[model samples]
Target: MDELVERVDAEDRVLGVVSRRDAVREGWLHRIGVVVCRDGQGRYLVHRRAEHLSRFPGHHELAVGGAVGVGESYEGAAARELSEEMGVRATVCLRFTFLNRSGLSPHWLAVCDALLPEAVAPDPREVAWHGWLTEPELRQALGQKTFTPDSREVFDRYLASRAAPATVRNRCP
Candidate 1:
C-alpha cells in the first residue's frame, strides 16, 4: 500500500497530504526521515537494501529511514524506522534537514541521529545485509560500492555538516 505523506512547500511548510506514489510520480516535495545509527563505539550501522525491494534494490544505505507519515514528526518517523528496520528502540534527534533532488523526486530529508547502545539484527525483508563501518571506512565504501543516489547525497551532506564551513544545519520540517 502506498503511504500517506505530508506534502510540503520549498521551505518545508506543510502544503497538504498526498499519497507517496503521487508524490514521487508528480515530483511533489515530501518528507523523509532517516536516522544515522551509531553504536556506542561510534560506528555507523550501514545496511544493504534487500534485493527484492523495488526501489534501489541491492544497494547499500548508510542509515535506517523511510517516509514521514502524514501528521508524523520527523523524529517520530526516524524512531519508527529505526525500530522497524533495525529492531532498536532508541531516541533519535534531528541533526539537519535538506532538500534532496538527486533522486527521482524532491524530498525534505530529515537526517537524524541515534546512538545505539548495541547492535541488533535488522529486518531481513528490508535489509539484505548490514555492518558497522567507521567514518573513514564508510567514505571509502561510498566510492567503492554502489549506493542509492539519495543516500550518497545524504552521507555527503552529513559529513559536510561536521567539517565544512556551511551546511543545512538545524532545518526542520
Candidate 2:
C-alpha cells in the first residue's frame, strides 16, 4: 500500500497529508517516530536495514521507526513501528527531540526508549540483521558512519537526554 504521510511546514507545523513518494520527492517536512529498545543487560538493539529498502539500504539504525501516518499520533506511530519492525510490544514514552532537516528527507524526530527483556525478532523485509551493542560499541560505530543519518541524529539526542539532569528530563512538556 502507498503510505500517506503527515506533511509539515519548515517549522514542523502540520500542513496536511501527502503520499509518501511525493513527500520524499518534494522534500516535504514530515514526522518520524523512533523507539530505542534496550534489554535487561543494558545493551541497545540495533538493526541492519534490508538491502531492498528505498533509503539507506543495508545501513545500521539505532532505533525502530518510520514516518508518521496521516492522522496518527507520534506515540502511536512509535509503538506501531517498534512492533512492526522488531516484533516486540512496547510502551512508548515519547520525547520530542528535534527537527532534523538534513539529507533528502526532513522530519520532526521524536524519540523514546522502550525497555524489553525478551529477545527481538526483526522482520526480514525491514531488517537484514540485528545485534546488541554496548554504549562504547555504539559510539565507535557512530564514528565509522555505520548508522543511517536519522539513526545518528536519534542516537545523539538519546545521549544528550541521558546527560541531562534528572530534574530537567522529568519535567512535563
Candidate 3:
C-alpha cells in the first residue's frame, strides 16, 4: 500500500506519482502493467494470488503484474513483473492498454504477452499456485468471483482483439 505508483487520468496520461494507498482510496486512475506468459504449447500461465495480498487476494489471475513505477514504461514494468513472479527474464510485448474500471479500483491496465523460456519458478509469496491453462480452461476459471474482475475484462479484450479484423482493431476506442 505504501508503494509509490504512477497516477494517470482517465485518458491514461501520467499526472504524477502517488502512494498506492491514496490512489485506491481516492479512485484515481493509475498504471498497472500485466504480463501474460504463454508456453510453446500456447497455454497461458494462470496463477492464484497469495492470500496475504491486500488487493485481489486468493483470486485467479491470467497475468502476473503490479503497479508501474513512477519512471517506468509499461513494457518495462511488465517485464519486471514477469521476472519477479516467474523467476525468468523474457521480453514482453505491449498487446494493449485500456482503462480498467472493474471492482473498486480503477486503473489504466497495460496488457503484455511473453513467450516463456524453459525455466519457470513461481514465487511462493506472490503466487500461491500456478499452472499452464488452455484458453478454454482460462475461460471456465473466470466464471467465479474469485477471479479478478479486471483480469476477466482483460480476457474479454484479448478475445476481442483476436476475433476483430485488423481494420477494426486499429480503431480501438
Candidate 4:
C-alpha cells in the first residue's frame, strides 16, 4: 500500500491535497494511531518506533499508527496502522477528539483507543518492540518524557475522559 499523507495549513485545516513523502518531509500531514489496552487480565500493546525513524526514533507509542493517506478516513488509517505495525487485524472504535500538535508543524492527529486479543506481531521496519504498560507505569513514563509529546497528549485526554462522570438519565419529566 502507498504511504499515508495529508495537506493542512498552519492552523491544521485540511487543504484537500495529499502526498505521502511530501507530508513527512514538509510536516504538513495528518496522522492517526490506535491505543490498545486490555481489561483486568493485564494485556495491552504499545510499539517502540524503529531507531531509523525520521521522527521520534526509539520512543514507545500506542499500537499501530501512521499518516492518513489520500481519500482515507481517520478510522481507516487507524485500522491500517494496526495491521501494518502490529500484524493484528480487528475492528476499531474511534473517538471524536483529535489530539493535534500544531506547534510542531502543520500536522494534525486523530487518535483512537481499542481492545484486542493477546496475539500480536510487530513490524521491524516501523516498530522495534511491543509491550504492555500498566496505568501507573504509563503515567510515570509520560511524566519522565518517555513518550512523544503527541502521544502524551493523547493518553492524557484518554485518561481524563475515562474519569469523567457519565450523564445521569432523566426519566418521566
Q: Whose lDDT is greatest here? A: 1
Model 3 Cα lDDT, one tens digit per residue, 69-135: 8899988999998888878898887778888888668888888877896458988998898888888
The residue-level lDDT of candidate 2 at 14 comes to 83
Please, what's the RMSD in Å of model 1?
A: 3.0
lDDT tens readout by residue for model 1, 1-173: 88999999999999998899999999999999999888888788899999999878999988789999988999999999899988889888788888888666999998897788765868999999999999899989999998888777788777776564434445321
Clashing pairs in 4: none
Off by over 4 Å in 1: 163-173
Each model's lDDT comes to 0.86, 0.82, 0.83, 0.64
Clashes of each: 0, 0, 0, 0
Error of 1 at 116 (Å): 0.8
TM-scores, all candidates, are 0.91, 0.91, 0.89, 0.77
Better of 1 and 3 by lDDT: 1
Better of 2 and 3 by TM-score: 2
Clashes of 4: 0
Q: Write the per-residue lDDT of candidate 2 for residues 1-173, one digit (tens) a residue.
A: 78999898877788987888888888888888888888888889988999999888999888888888988877789899989988889788775567887646777887877887658888999999999999999888878856787777777778778678877665422
TM-score for predicted model 4 compared with the true structure: 0.77
